[model samples]
Target chain A: MNTATAPAGPGRGPATHDIRNQIVVAATEHFSHYGYEKTTVSDLAKAIGFSKAYVYKFFESKQAIGEAICSNCLAQLEQEIGQALEGVEQPAERMRKLFKASTEAHQRLLSQDRKLYEIAQSAAAEHWPSVLAYEDRLRALLQHLLLQGRDSGDFERKTPLDEATDAIYLVLRPYLNPLLLPHSLDHNDQAPTLLCSLVLRSLSP
Target chain B: MNTATAPAGPGRGPATHDIRNQIVVAATEHFSHYGYEKTTVSDLAKAIGFSKAYVYKFFESKQAIGEAICSNCLAQLEQEIGQALEGVEQPAERMRKLFKASTEAHQRLLSQDRKLYEIAQSAAAEHWPSVLAYEDRLRALLQHLLLQGRDSGDFERKTPLDEATDAIYLVLRPYLNPLLLPHSLDHNDQAPTLLCSLVLRSLSP
Candidate 1:
């Protein structure tokens, strides 16, 4: 269904785009306050002063809305990492900044609100296709950095690029996954540095 | 509670020690057939022709019985790995065999019975202290092998023993964790070799 041509509400208060944005914003709050399983479409619609039917018009289901929030959160995280790596030419320095940025973003999300972290955990555990796509994008980013390092004579090309990427991901799993590294919350500063050091050593010529 | 003095059953039956062994054997079968949650002390006793009180005399609870099974399985796995590396003196060769034995043992356990695998998954997920102890033993084994490699000039001592051990575990998580490496069932032979190669390369002098 073309959402753009969908019938507008009676009152001239907000446009359809504004309503969609409002729904997402309110849904985020609801999800953050109440866990993914607890929040319902009726509760979301009641909070936003919209009919349940109208909420359905914008999102197909509660899971779809949760996915939208997860997608947006991950996209924002990627953008932050990208912005951090801008103008960083050296592969090692680029990787350091990338990991630092990724860890800090996750730490912030984990500390700011636990429900958001729960949503991410659910996304990963449930194998949401969008989350997997985001992981692929992250892996591609690492591969690009590795290739640059190889070209600059900083890293040895001892293994295939794909295998190397997998290696990096596996090695950094503890640092990347909050669920796996609970102690990281206490030693946030040291964990990333140690992990980055190991990665760089593995890539060293 | 001193279990040695427990009274024997009627007839020319086995002693209390044998009865305890019988309970564990019967419990393993029950857990492997019906899973951890479904199997109960009463059912176990009924299967072995003993009273529920007698089963309780042997095990504290159902979770305790599950832990016993998990501990026994992990101990047997460690013994198998130790036996595999019996004649190998070289650090690199020993590591290769250790990993190969570990992967093959886990694969065997996973493929032999679905219920057994599920019990292991539950044990790990629940973080049974016995399972954690087993993991620490495995990590110590890896650290010992790494130290041997460094002493014999097979591997570089670029990183501290603890950090290197952590790195090895991180890199080998997929190979070691059946849940993480689902694709391993198909490529069992190549997976261990590929993982060992990456590990050895990372530790190359």
Candidate 2:
């Protein structure tokens, strides 16, 4: 089998993966300076020191590039939440940490890099695959925390677990979402802390 | 002031109001077919058999017309929620009816007239004044309901009234929001009903 003759099959090769990472890095920087909607593929290609065709070879469109950047940013947020919950003894406290860490992570993106936050906002508004995947991971994490609370006799067991998890996720959505961040900020009078407390109360056995 | 010289501020006269309604109706239809983003002011004027300048006399821009339509739709939703809660004596049950009616009304708009819904979707995502006003009225209504619940011995009164209302509003936001409607639909398997129950349970003494 001639390795050179085989198709890359969506960045399967080590060299191709390296190039993809380089492209993502440069595109993120370009988006940060120029904003996601204002920056064009040609602009990204030129900034990355690659031909327009080369950039197109890596991404089908500018949206594809945006999706990649958004996915990375969201993954970082998820990791922050995971670390925030590590070694936490109480399930309710673990949930509070998750909410606080997620809100803080999103607030940083919203304040420090509004351009990147816009990418995430569009991703959520448009239902991009990256956002869908992030939401699924988040729901799973919440479900795990709920189960922990149930087993510890800290939460009611009568409500169906899956439905309760989704309901809980819905309650946290405004704070967790990029688009709804401004809405959350409007009531910045310890709203998140109080919301977490209310939700914890709902879960009490 | 001379009657002829008096400036009619924003839809004052009967004749002017009639023309404005005509423009709104025609623009709503145009937006339904071509979408809000694609349909231009010029295109709308042509459809309504009026000059572009004449259309501008009523509305400053295309977004202004969109705002008018969004305001009307949201007002209707508010009215429906009010009607649904009417005559419901139980505090928790009143909350339930409010949630159901709001969800149904939005579902109708989203499923029946997505173009109008798109106008609403943009209004919410962009934080138009219409939505801001609607949120204020909704919050006020919820506060009233919480007070009812407290007085009737149905819900706990320890949590600050305003914060609890805000938390309940957040839980219902995903389903009520046109932008997040699709996301809510994904979990449409009794998610709304269950979520309402969960919120009501949180209010238990």
Candidate 3:
């Protein structure tokens, strides 16, 4: 697990790291395509041109690989949202940006790595510990953004911060949810914009 | 399959219907207590003092019985909401009553038939056709109500009625979801009222 020891050879410089990332990416794709029950470790190894033993050396099991991929995807999403909220001063503008960024981030993921998005969706529904933990973390991040909005007078008088945060999530749940969005809308050219508008409308002060 | 089969025998009259109802009621209890996959058909039959074969005659399979029970539960819920909307007129009031009624109806089902509620929750997540059809029907019913409200000029709105309808459904989805509120508030409790208020706030002109 020593990070500095990973690319210890001349020819394998960065190749080892790339291989692991590729396996995680491929596993995510497979999980998304077939769902948890249908996906297999051997198939994932085959997809990435790695021996099953090689894959196992990097990750203990298929579920472990899935957990790591989801962890990485969600971490990147959370980081993007945090960065987007950095410069905005007004509460309402910040709230608006939060929603816009959410849709944009989601769209970027869906467009670039659709299978990974689906895997994340399936993981969210299942009772996996890692998935649930990541969701809790996401909820906390949104809560912080909402609290910031409230402090700036963007949100109206309402319940406490936690409740308000939950309300916001509730409103956007359908659109955030891969399973809930209309299939036509999911693939539509204008989906990201339309979805962002609808979400923003719900949050207007 | 005949629509006009003779009503059992002289002594069997209400007892026959009672026994059948009891079986379903007991099945619900068993399913709630043990969960759908864990509960057995024989356990249900035995709980109601009947043979497994007799239960099969009443229901072709466990899944068939589950489907029947789910339909019965949803139909009853639809009937309750339809009844609640009759004496209400104002748009806001109608929306309030709808939420209240939905909460109460879900609570009633949970209290009276927990197993069925749990089964339906799992089914809803798994894309059970019956549950999806039931949700579609419920959405249509809600749409009709929203259209009526629009015509009455009770609701102030910038969005189209269809989008508004979907938004309202999104808001109410948590309350209708037995999986989320299994142990906490009763159906007609404070959460629905609070959430509905937030939704109505968003919908106002």
Index of the highest-lDDT prediction: 2
Residue A18 lDDT in candidate 3: 78
**Lowest summed lDDT over 10 consecutive residues: which window, candidate 3 chain A?**
A180-189
Pairs of colliding residues, candidate 1:
none
Candidate 3 ranges with C-alpha deviation above 4 Å: A1-75, A83-97, A100-166, A173-199, A202-205, B1-22, B46-49, B107-116, B126-130, B156-158, B179-191
1 or 2, which is superior by TM-score?
1
Every candidate's DockQ is 0.20, 0.35, 0.13
The whole-model C-alpha lDDT of candidate 2 against the native structure comes to 0.82
Cα lDDT for residue A172, model 2? 76
Chain B TM-score for each model?
0.84, 0.92, 0.72
In the range A66-170, model 3's lDDT, one tens digit per residue, is 777777877888789778888887766666677667666766776676555656656655535665675577678778766776666665546566666665665
Chain A (alone) TM-scores for all candidate structures: 0.86, 0.91, 0.68
Please tell me which model should have the higher lDDT, number 1 or number 3. 1
**Top-DockQ candidate index:** 2
> How big an interface RMSD has model 1?
4.5
lDDT of 2 by residue, B1-205 (tens): 6644333335468988888889899999889988897788999899889999888878878888999899888889899999999889999999898888888888888889766677887887788999989988987888898999999899999888887998888777767776666566654547678778888879998
Of candidate 2 chain B, the 10-residue stretch with the lowest lDDT total is B2-11
Instruction: Report the C-alpha lDDT of model 1 over B173-201, residue by residue, as the tens digit.
Output: 55565454443333235656665676777
Q: Could you tell me the lDDT of residue A142 within candidate 3?
A: 73
Under CAPRI classification, how is model 1 graded? incorrect
